[model samples]
Target: MDYKYIEQLIERYFACETTLQEEQILRSFFSQGNVPSNLSEYADLFRYESSESNIHLGEEFDARMMELVERKSGMKNKVVSIRGKFTPLFKAAAIVAIVLTIGNAAEQSIGNRPSEGFDDVTAINPYIKKDNISAAIKVKDNTQAETKTVVKSDSLLIENND
Candidate 1:
Protein backbone atom coordinates (compact mmCIF):
# COMPACT_ATOMS: atom_id res chain seq x y z
CA MET A 1 0.00 0.00 0.00
CA ASP A 2 1.31 3.48 -0.84
CA TYR A 3 1.42 5.37 2.51
CA LYS A 4 3.43 8.33 1.14
CA TYR A 5 0.34 10.64 1.35
CA ILE A 6 -0.46 9.49 4.88
CA GLU A 7 3.19 10.00 5.97
CA GLN A 8 3.18 13.52 4.51
CA LEU A 9 -0.13 14.37 6.26
CA ILE A 10 1.20 13.08 9.58
CA GLU A 11 4.35 15.26 9.22
CA ARG A 12 2.19 18.31 8.42
CA TYR A 13 -0.10 17.51 11.37
CA PHE A 14 2.88 17.37 13.81
CA ALA A 15 4.17 20.65 12.32
CA CYS A 16 0.67 22.24 12.92
CA GLU A 17 0.35 22.97 9.16
CA THR A 18 -2.51 20.47 8.50
CA THR A 19 -6.02 21.86 7.78
CA LEU A 20 -9.13 20.45 9.51
CA GLN A 21 -9.87 18.33 6.44
CA GLU A 22 -6.33 16.95 6.47
CA GLU A 23 -6.66 16.14 10.22
CA GLN A 24 -10.02 14.38 9.64
CA ILE A 25 -8.40 12.35 6.92
CA LEU A 26 -5.61 11.37 9.33
CA ARG A 27 -8.15 10.33 12.01
CA SER A 28 -10.14 8.32 9.43
CA PHE A 29 -6.95 6.65 8.21
CA PHE A 30 -5.89 5.72 11.75
CA SER A 31 -9.40 4.58 12.77
CA GLN A 32 -9.01 1.73 10.29
CA GLY A 33 -7.18 -1.15 12.03
CA ASN A 34 -5.00 -1.80 8.95
CA VAL A 35 -2.51 1.11 9.42
CA PRO A 36 1.05 0.35 8.12
CA SER A 37 3.54 -0.97 10.70
CA ASN A 38 5.93 2.01 10.11
CA LEU A 39 3.10 4.55 10.94
CA SER A 40 1.63 2.59 13.86
CA GLU A 41 3.27 4.95 16.42
CA TYR A 42 0.77 7.80 15.53
CA ALA A 43 -2.31 5.54 15.53
CA ASP A 44 -3.08 5.97 19.28
CA LEU A 45 -2.85 9.78 19.09
CA PHE A 46 -5.41 10.07 16.22
CA ARG A 47 -7.68 7.41 17.79
CA TYR A 48 -7.71 9.29 21.13
CA GLU A 49 -8.63 12.52 19.32
CA SER A 50 -11.51 10.73 17.52
CA SER A 51 -12.80 9.20 20.78
CA GLU A 52 -12.61 12.54 22.66
CA SER A 53 -14.52 14.28 19.86
CA ASN A 54 -17.47 11.90 20.49
CA ILE A 55 -17.73 13.04 24.18
CA HIS A 56 -20.44 15.65 25.05
CA LEU A 57 -22.31 17.09 28.06
CA GLY A 58 -25.52 15.30 29.04
CA GLU A 59 -29.00 17.06 28.92
CA GLU A 60 -28.99 17.53 32.73
CA PHE A 61 -25.56 19.26 32.76
CA ASP A 62 -26.92 22.83 32.60
CA ALA A 63 -29.76 22.14 35.04
CA ARG A 64 -27.39 20.55 37.59
CA MET A 65 -24.92 23.47 37.31
CA MET A 66 -27.72 26.05 37.90
CA GLU A 67 -29.00 24.13 40.95
CA LEU A 68 -25.50 24.09 42.53
CA VAL A 69 -25.06 27.81 41.83
CA GLU A 70 -28.42 28.67 43.46
CA ARG A 71 -27.70 26.52 46.49
CA LYS A 72 -24.39 28.32 47.13
CA SER A 73 -25.83 31.79 46.38
CA GLY A 74 -28.68 31.31 48.85
CA MET A 75 -26.14 31.47 51.68
CA LYS A 76 -24.42 34.49 50.14
CA ASN A 77 -27.63 36.59 49.87
CA LYS A 78 -27.48 37.83 53.50
CA VAL A 79 -29.42 41.05 54.23
CA VAL A 80 -27.53 44.05 55.65
CA SER A 81 -29.62 46.92 57.08
CA ILE A 82 -28.64 50.58 56.56
CA ARG A 83 -27.79 50.95 60.24
CA GLY A 84 -25.57 47.83 60.15
CA LYS A 85 -23.64 49.17 57.17
CA PHE A 86 -23.01 52.55 58.88
CA THR A 87 -22.28 51.16 62.39
CA PRO A 88 -18.49 51.05 61.93
CA LEU A 89 -18.40 54.61 60.61
CA PHE A 90 -20.54 55.79 63.53
CA LYS A 91 -18.21 54.09 66.04
CA ALA A 92 -15.15 55.69 64.42
CA ALA A 93 -16.77 59.15 64.51
CA ALA A 94 -17.70 58.71 68.18
CA ILE A 95 -14.11 57.66 69.05
CA VAL A 96 -12.75 60.70 67.20
CA ALA A 97 -15.14 63.07 69.02
CA ILE A 98 -14.18 61.60 72.41
CA VAL A 99 -10.46 61.86 71.66
CA LEU A 100 -10.82 65.48 70.51
CA THR A 101 -12.86 66.44 73.59
CA ILE A 102 -10.32 64.86 75.98
CA GLY A 103 -7.45 66.50 74.13
CA ASN A 104 -9.13 69.94 74.30
CA ALA A 105 -9.88 69.58 78.00
CA ALA A 106 -6.30 68.56 78.78
CA GLU A 107 -4.98 71.50 76.74
CA GLN A 108 -7.28 73.96 78.58
CA SER A 109 -6.27 72.59 81.98
CA ILE A 110 -2.56 72.83 81.14
CA GLY A 111 -2.96 76.32 79.70
CA ASN A 112 -4.86 77.64 82.75
CA ARG A 113 -2.28 76.41 85.29
CA PRO A 114 0.61 78.74 86.28
CA SER A 115 3.86 77.91 84.40
CA GLU A 116 6.37 78.13 87.27
CA GLY A 117 9.22 76.62 85.21
CA PHE A 118 8.98 79.29 82.47
CA ASP A 119 8.12 82.25 84.79
CA ASP A 120 11.34 82.00 86.85
CA VAL A 121 14.33 82.98 84.70
CA THR A 122 16.75 81.76 87.44
CA ALA A 123 15.36 78.17 87.08
CA ILE A 124 16.12 78.19 83.34
CA ASN A 125 19.50 79.99 83.47
CA PRO A 126 22.33 78.72 85.71
CA TYR A 127 24.91 81.34 84.61
CA ILE A 128 22.84 84.44 85.74
CA LYS A 129 22.97 84.72 89.57
CA LYS A 130 20.68 86.92 91.74
CA ASP A 131 23.72 88.77 93.14
CA ASN A 132 24.96 89.78 89.68
CA ILE A 133 21.50 91.17 88.76
CA SER A 134 21.27 93.11 92.06
CA ALA A 135 24.76 94.57 91.51
CA ALA A 136 23.83 95.69 87.97
CA ILE A 137 20.65 97.38 89.35
CA LYS A 138 22.69 99.19 92.03
CA VAL A 139 25.18 100.43 89.42
CA LYS A 140 22.34 101.78 87.21
CA ASP A 141 20.74 103.53 90.28
CA ASN A 142 24.09 105.13 91.31
CA THR A 143 24.64 106.41 87.78
CA GLN A 144 21.17 108.01 87.80
CA ALA A 145 21.83 109.63 91.20
CA GLU A 146 25.22 111.00 90.04
CA THR A 147 23.61 112.48 86.90
CA LYS A 148 20.93 114.27 89.01
CA THR A 149 23.56 115.84 91.36
CA VAL A 150 25.68 117.00 88.42
CA VAL A 151 22.56 118.69 86.86
CA LYS A 152 21.79 120.49 90.19
CA SER A 153 25.40 121.77 90.49
CA ASP A 154 25.36 123.06 86.90
CA SER A 155 22.05 124.90 87.54
CA LEU A 156 23.47 126.60 90.67
CA LEU A 157 26.60 127.74 88.76
CA ILE A 158 24.47 129.09 85.92
CA GLU A 159 22.32 131.13 88.38
CA ASN A 160 25.44 132.68 90.03
CA ASN A 161 26.91 133.59 86.66
CA ASP A 162 23.63 135.36 85.70
Candidate 2:
Protein backbone atom coordinates (compact mmCIF):
# COMPACT_ATOMS: atom_id res chain seq x y z
CA MET A 1 0.00 0.00 0.00
CA ASP A 2 1.13 3.54 -0.81
CA TYR A 3 2.14 5.29 2.39
CA LYS A 4 1.85 8.71 0.70
CA TYR A 5 -1.78 9.04 1.83
CA ILE A 6 -0.72 8.01 5.36
CA GLU A 7 1.98 10.69 5.32
CA GLN A 8 -0.54 13.33 4.26
CA LEU A 9 -2.91 12.17 7.01
CA ILE A 10 -0.13 12.40 9.56
CA GLU A 11 0.56 15.97 8.46
CA ARG A 12 -3.17 16.79 8.76
CA TYR A 13 -3.19 15.20 12.24
CA PHE A 14 -0.36 17.52 13.39
CA ALA A 15 -2.25 20.44 11.85
CA CYS A 16 -5.45 19.36 13.67
CA GLU A 17 -7.27 18.89 10.35
CA THR A 18 -7.64 15.06 10.22
CA THR A 19 -11.09 13.51 10.66
CA LEU A 20 -11.73 10.62 13.05
CA GLN A 21 -11.60 8.11 10.20
CA GLU A 22 -8.31 9.45 8.93
CA GLU A 23 -6.86 9.25 12.51
CA GLN A 24 -8.12 5.66 12.81
CA ILE A 25 -6.43 4.83 9.52
CA LEU A 26 -3.20 6.32 10.75
CA ARG A 27 -3.41 4.38 14.01
CA SER A 28 -4.11 1.15 12.16
CA PHE A 29 -1.24 1.66 9.73
CA PHE A 30 1.34 2.57 12.37
CA SER A 31 0.29 -0.30 14.69
CA GLN A 32 1.71 -2.91 12.25
CA GLY A 33 5.28 -3.98 13.02
CA ASN A 34 6.41 -3.32 9.41
CA VAL A 35 6.60 0.50 9.46
CA PRO A 36 8.73 2.45 6.97
CA SER A 37 11.91 3.99 8.40
CA ASN A 38 10.79 7.59 7.77
CA LEU A 39 7.50 7.07 9.77
CA SER A 40 9.00 4.89 12.52
CA GLU A 41 8.90 7.75 15.10
CA TYR A 42 5.08 7.82 15.00
CA ALA A 43 4.79 4.02 15.27
CA ASP A 44 5.31 3.99 19.07
CA LEU A 45 2.52 6.52 19.67
CA PHE A 46 -0.08 4.65 17.61
CA ARG A 47 1.05 1.30 19.02
CA TYR A 48 0.58 2.71 22.52
CA GLU A 49 -2.95 3.79 21.60
CA SER A 50 -3.66 0.28 20.33
CA SER A 51 -2.35 -1.25 23.58
CA GLU A 52 -4.39 1.22 25.66
CA SER A 53 -7.54 0.40 23.71
CA ASN A 54 -7.03 -3.31 24.39
CA ILE A 55 -6.69 -2.77 28.15
CA HIS A 56 -9.63 -4.16 30.20
CA LEU A 57 -10.38 -3.87 33.92
CA GLY A 58 -10.45 -7.04 35.99
CA GLU A 59 -13.86 -8.55 36.95
CA GLU A 60 -13.48 -7.42 40.58
CA PHE A 61 -12.19 -3.92 39.74
CA ASP A 62 -15.53 -2.13 40.26
CA ALA A 63 -16.14 -3.99 43.49
CA ARG A 64 -12.73 -3.00 44.80
CA MET A 65 -13.13 0.67 43.86
CA MET A 66 -16.60 0.89 45.39
CA GLU A 67 -15.37 -0.88 48.52
CA LEU A 68 -12.65 1.77 48.84
CA VAL A 69 -15.17 4.60 48.40
CA GLU A 70 -17.55 3.06 50.96
CA ARG A 71 -14.72 2.57 53.43
CA LYS A 72 -13.72 6.23 53.19
CA SER A 73 -17.32 7.38 53.62
CA GLY A 74 -17.80 5.06 56.60
CA MET A 75 -14.73 6.60 58.28
CA LYS A 76 -16.01 10.13 57.66
CA ASN A 77 -19.46 9.26 59.05
CA LYS A 78 -17.89 8.14 62.34
CA VAL A 79 -16.82 11.73 63.15
CA VAL A 80 -20.35 13.25 63.29
CA SER A 81 -22.50 10.13 63.69
CA ILE A 82 -24.13 10.68 67.10
CA ARG A 83 -26.40 7.63 67.01
CA GLY A 84 -23.79 5.04 66.07
CA LYS A 85 -21.68 2.69 68.28
CA PHE A 86 -20.15 5.49 70.42
CA THR A 87 -23.40 7.26 71.41
CA PRO A 88 -23.60 5.90 74.93
CA LEU A 89 -19.93 6.68 75.58
CA PHE A 90 -20.35 10.21 74.27
CA LYS A 91 -23.38 10.77 76.52
CA ALA A 92 -21.50 9.51 79.56
CA ALA A 93 -18.55 11.85 78.83
CA ALA A 94 -20.85 14.84 78.52
CA ILE A 95 -22.57 13.99 81.81
CA VAL A 96 -19.20 13.63 83.53
CA ALA A 97 -18.07 17.03 82.19
CA ILE A 98 -21.25 18.75 83.45
CA VAL A 99 -20.89 17.14 86.89
CA LEU A 100 -17.25 18.22 87.13
CA THR A 101 -18.11 21.82 86.18
CA ILE A 102 -20.87 22.05 88.79
CA GLY A 103 -18.60 20.53 91.45
CA ASN A 104 -15.84 23.05 90.61
CA ALA A 105 -18.27 25.97 90.84
CA ALA A 106 -19.52 24.83 94.24
CA GLU A 107 -15.96 24.38 95.55
CA GLN A 108 -14.94 27.87 94.34
CA SER A 109 -17.97 29.51 96.03
CA ILE A 110 -17.28 27.79 99.32
CA GLY A 111 -13.69 29.01 99.44
CA ASN A 112 -14.14 32.58 98.03
CA ARG A 113 -16.12 34.03 100.93
CA PRO A 114 -14.10 37.06 102.12
CA SER A 115 -12.99 37.26 105.78
CA GLU A 116 -11.36 40.00 107.82
CA GLY A 117 -7.86 40.09 109.57
CA PHE A 118 -5.39 40.01 106.65
CA ASP A 119 -6.13 36.52 105.39
CA ASP A 120 -5.13 37.32 101.82
CA VAL A 121 -1.57 36.95 100.44
CA THR A 122 -1.22 40.67 99.69
CA ALA A 123 -1.17 41.79 103.37
CA ILE A 124 1.95 39.69 104.07
CA ASN A 125 4.11 41.94 101.82
CA PRO A 126 4.58 45.28 103.68
CA TYR A 127 7.01 46.63 100.99
CA ILE A 128 4.17 46.53 98.38
CA LYS A 129 3.32 50.24 98.83
CA LYS A 130 0.91 51.76 96.26
CA ASP A 131 3.35 54.59 95.42
CA ASN A 132 6.25 52.15 94.81
CA ILE A 133 4.00 49.92 92.69
CA SER A 134 2.96 52.89 90.53
CA ALA A 135 6.60 53.96 90.13
CA ALA A 136 7.60 50.43 89.05
CA ILE A 137 4.74 50.35 86.52
CA LYS A 138 5.91 53.67 85.04
CA VAL A 139 9.44 52.29 84.74
CA LYS A 140 8.06 49.18 83.03
CA ASP A 141 6.08 51.35 80.61
CA ASN A 142 9.21 53.36 79.76
CA THR A 143 11.18 50.09 79.21
CA GLN A 144 8.43 48.77 76.90
CA ALA A 145 8.60 51.97 74.81
CA GLU A 146 12.39 51.55 74.58
CA THR A 147 11.85 47.88 73.57
CA LYS A 148 9.50 48.96 70.79
CA THR A 149 12.08 51.43 69.47
CA VAL A 150 14.77 48.72 69.64
CA VAL A 151 12.52 46.23 67.78
CA LYS A 152 11.87 48.77 65.03
CA SER A 153 15.60 49.42 64.61
CA ASP A 154 16.36 45.67 64.64
CA SER A 155 13.75 45.03 61.88
CA LEU A 156 15.32 47.72 59.72
CA LEU A 157 18.74 46.20 60.31
CA ILE A 158 17.47 42.70 59.37
CA GLU A 159 15.88 44.03 56.17
CA ASN A 160 19.07 45.84 55.21
CA ASN A 161 21.08 42.66 55.90
CA ASP A 162 18.81 40.73 53.53
Candidate 3:
Protein backbone atom coordinates (compact mmCIF):
# COMPACT_ATOMS: atom_id res chain seq x y z
CA MET A 1 0.00 0.00 0.00
CA ASP A 2 2.13 2.83 -1.29
CA TYR A 3 0.38 6.04 -0.03
CA LYS A 4 3.11 8.26 -1.52
CA TYR A 5 0.93 9.11 -4.55
CA ILE A 6 -2.12 9.84 -2.33
CA GLU A 7 0.02 12.03 -0.07
CA GLN A 8 1.23 13.93 -3.11
CA LEU A 9 -2.36 14.38 -4.29
CA ILE A 10 -3.37 15.59 -0.80
CA GLU A 11 -0.59 18.19 -0.97
CA ARG A 12 -2.02 19.33 -4.33
CA TYR A 13 -5.53 19.29 -2.86
CA PHE A 14 -4.47 21.60 0.01
CA ALA A 15 -2.79 23.99 -2.44
CA CYS A 16 -6.00 23.95 -4.57
CA GLU A 17 -4.11 22.43 -7.49
CA THR A 18 -5.69 18.95 -7.77
CA THR A 19 -7.81 18.01 -10.79
CA LEU A 20 -11.37 16.65 -10.34
CA GLN A 21 -10.15 13.04 -11.04
CA GLU A 22 -7.31 13.36 -8.54
CA GLU A 23 -9.74 14.67 -5.92
CA GLN A 24 -12.08 11.71 -6.55
CA ILE A 25 -9.20 9.26 -6.17
CA LEU A 26 -8.19 10.89 -2.87
CA ARG A 27 -11.78 10.61 -1.49
CA SER A 28 -12.00 6.93 -2.49
CA PHE A 29 -8.65 6.09 -0.89
CA PHE A 30 -9.50 7.81 2.41
CA SER A 31 -13.02 6.27 2.60
CA GLN A 32 -11.39 2.74 3.00
CA GLY A 33 -9.90 3.71 6.47
CA ASN A 34 -6.38 2.42 5.57
CA VAL A 35 -4.96 5.97 6.10
CA PRO A 36 -1.67 6.28 8.06
CA SER A 37 -1.72 7.87 11.54
CA ASN A 38 -0.04 11.00 10.11
CA LEU A 39 -2.79 11.32 7.46
CA SER A 40 -5.80 10.45 9.69
CA GLU A 41 -6.65 14.17 10.18
CA TYR A 42 -7.14 14.59 6.40
CA ALA A 43 -9.31 11.45 6.16
CA ASP A 44 -12.33 13.16 7.75
CA LEU A 45 -12.12 15.96 5.19
CA PHE A 46 -12.27 13.52 2.26
CA ARG A 47 -15.01 11.43 3.89
CA TYR A 48 -17.06 14.60 4.42
CA GLU A 49 -16.81 15.41 0.71
CA SER A 50 -18.01 11.92 -0.26
CA SER A 51 -20.94 12.18 2.11
CA GLU A 52 -21.85 15.69 0.91
CA SER A 53 -21.66 14.54 -2.72
CA ASN A 54 -24.21 11.83 -1.94
CA ILE A 55 -26.54 14.32 -0.17
CA HIS A 56 -29.36 16.05 -2.08
CA LEU A 57 -32.06 18.65 -1.44
CA GLY A 58 -35.12 16.45 -0.88
CA GLU A 59 -38.76 16.95 -1.91
CA GLU A 60 -39.52 18.79 1.33
CA PHE A 61 -37.28 21.66 0.21
CA ASP A 62 -39.09 21.89 -3.11
CA ALA A 63 -42.45 21.86 -1.35
CA ARG A 64 -41.34 24.63 1.03
CA MET A 65 -40.04 26.76 -1.85
CA MET A 66 -43.33 26.33 -3.72
CA GLU A 67 -45.30 27.25 -0.60
CA LEU A 68 -43.33 30.46 -0.24
CA VAL A 69 -44.04 31.37 -3.86
CA GLU A 70 -47.72 30.62 -3.41
CA ARG A 71 -47.83 32.77 -0.28
CA LYS A 72 -46.37 35.74 -2.12
CA SER A 73 -48.75 35.25 -5.03
CA GLY A 74 -51.69 34.92 -2.64
CA MET A 75 -50.95 38.36 -1.21
CA LYS A 76 -51.46 39.79 -4.65
CA ASN A 77 -54.73 37.89 -4.97
CA LYS A 78 -55.97 39.38 -1.70
CA VAL A 79 -55.08 42.86 -2.83
CA VAL A 80 -56.98 42.37 -6.05
CA SER A 81 -59.96 41.05 -4.11
CA ILE A 82 -59.94 44.11 -1.88
CA ARG A 83 -59.77 46.44 -4.84
CA GLY A 84 -62.53 44.55 -6.61
CA LYS A 85 -64.72 44.86 -3.52
CA PHE A 86 -64.38 48.66 -3.45
CA THR A 87 -64.65 49.28 -7.19
CA PRO A 88 -68.44 49.01 -7.36
CA LEU A 89 -68.91 51.26 -4.34
CA PHE A 90 -66.70 53.89 -5.88
CA LYS A 91 -68.63 53.75 -9.16
CA ALA A 92 -71.96 53.93 -7.36
CA ALA A 93 -70.83 56.96 -5.37
CA ALA A 94 -69.68 58.71 -8.51
CA ILE A 95 -73.01 58.01 -10.23
CA VAL A 96 -74.97 59.25 -7.23
CA ALA A 97 -72.92 62.46 -7.11
CA ILE A 98 -73.56 63.09 -10.81
CA VAL A 99 -77.28 62.50 -10.39
CA LEU A 100 -77.44 64.84 -7.40
CA THR A 101 -75.57 67.53 -9.30
CA ILE A 102 -77.94 67.28 -12.26
CA GLY A 103 -80.97 67.35 -9.98
CA ASN A 104 -79.65 70.44 -8.18
CA ALA A 105 -79.02 72.18 -11.47
CA ALA A 106 -82.59 71.48 -12.62
CA GLU A 107 -83.97 72.75 -9.34
CA GLN A 108 -81.90 75.93 -9.56
CA SER A 109 -83.07 76.59 -13.12
CA ILE A 110 -86.68 76.16 -12.07
CA GLY A 111 -86.17 78.48 -9.08
CA ASN A 112 -84.71 81.18 -11.37
CA ARG A 113 -87.79 81.28 -13.61
CA PRO A 114 -89.06 84.75 -14.72
CA SER A 115 -91.93 86.25 -12.65
CA GLU A 116 -93.70 88.03 -15.55
CA GLY A 117 -96.47 86.00 -17.25
CA PHE A 118 -96.60 87.82 -20.64
CA ASP A 119 -93.32 86.24 -21.97
CA ASP A 120 -95.26 83.33 -23.57
CA VAL A 121 -98.07 85.50 -25.02
CA THR A 122 -96.04 86.40 -28.15
CA ALA A 123 -95.21 82.75 -28.75
CA ILE A 124 -98.90 81.93 -29.32
CA ASN A 125 -99.59 84.93 -31.63
CA PRO A 126 -97.00 86.51 -33.91
CA TYR A 127 -99.26 89.39 -35.11
CA ILE A 128 -100.44 92.12 -32.72
CA LYS A 129 -103.78 93.98 -33.26
CA LYS A 130 -103.84 97.80 -32.93
CA ASP A 131 -106.58 97.72 -30.19
CA ASN A 132 -104.65 95.06 -28.23
CA ILE A 133 -101.44 97.08 -28.60
CA SER A 134 -103.31 100.26 -27.44
CA ALA A 135 -104.74 98.29 -24.46
CA ALA A 136 -101.35 96.93 -23.56
CA ILE A 137 -99.89 100.43 -23.73
CA LYS A 138 -102.75 101.85 -21.61
CA VAL A 139 -102.20 99.11 -18.98
CA LYS A 140 -98.68 100.41 -18.43
CA ASP A 141 -99.83 104.07 -18.05
CA ASN A 142 -103.05 103.65 -15.92
CA THR A 143 -101.20 104.14 -12.60
CA GLN A 144 -101.47 108.00 -12.85
CA ALA A 145 -105.31 108.44 -12.84
CA GLU A 146 -106.42 111.21 -10.31
CA THR A 147 -109.92 111.30 -8.49
CA LYS A 148 -111.32 113.52 -5.58
CA THR A 149 -114.29 112.85 -3.16
CA VAL A 150 -115.93 115.06 -0.44
CA VAL A 151 -117.07 113.63 2.97
CA LYS A 152 -119.75 115.31 5.24
CA SER A 153 -118.81 115.71 8.99
CA ASP A 154 -121.45 114.73 11.60
CA SER A 155 -119.91 116.61 14.62
CA LEU A 156 -121.45 120.05 13.64
CA LEU A 157 -125.30 120.31 14.16
CA ILE A 158 -127.31 123.39 13.19
CA GLU A 159 -130.84 124.04 14.74
CA ASN A 160 -133.39 125.06 12.10
CA ASN A 161 -135.60 128.13 13.00
CA ASP A 162 -139.19 128.17 11.65
Sorted on lDDT, best first, the list reads: 1, 2, 3
lDDT of 2: 0.86
* N/CA/C clash count, model 2: 0
lDDT tens digits, residues 1-162, model 3? Answer: 677998899999999999999999998998995789989999999999899988889999999999999999999999999999999999999999999999999999986776564444554465756578678768765643321111122222222221
lDDT (10s digit) by residue, model 2, range 60-97? 99999999999999988877684677889989999999
Off by over 4 Å in 3: 51-75, 102-162
Question: Which one wins by lDDT: 1 or 3?
Answer: 1
Task: Count clashing residue pairs in model 3.
Answer: 0
Candidates sorted by TM-score, best first: 3, 1, 2
User: Of the candidates numbered 1 and 2, which has the greater lDDT value?
Assistant: 1
Given candidate 2, what's the lDDT at residue 90? 88
**How does candidate 1 score on lDDT?**
0.88
**Candidate 2 wrongly placed segments (more than 4 Å):** 65-162
TM-score of each: 0.39, 0.39, 0.47
| TM-score of candidate 1 on Cα atoms, chains taken together | 0.39
- Model 1, stretches more than 4 Å misplaced? 65-162
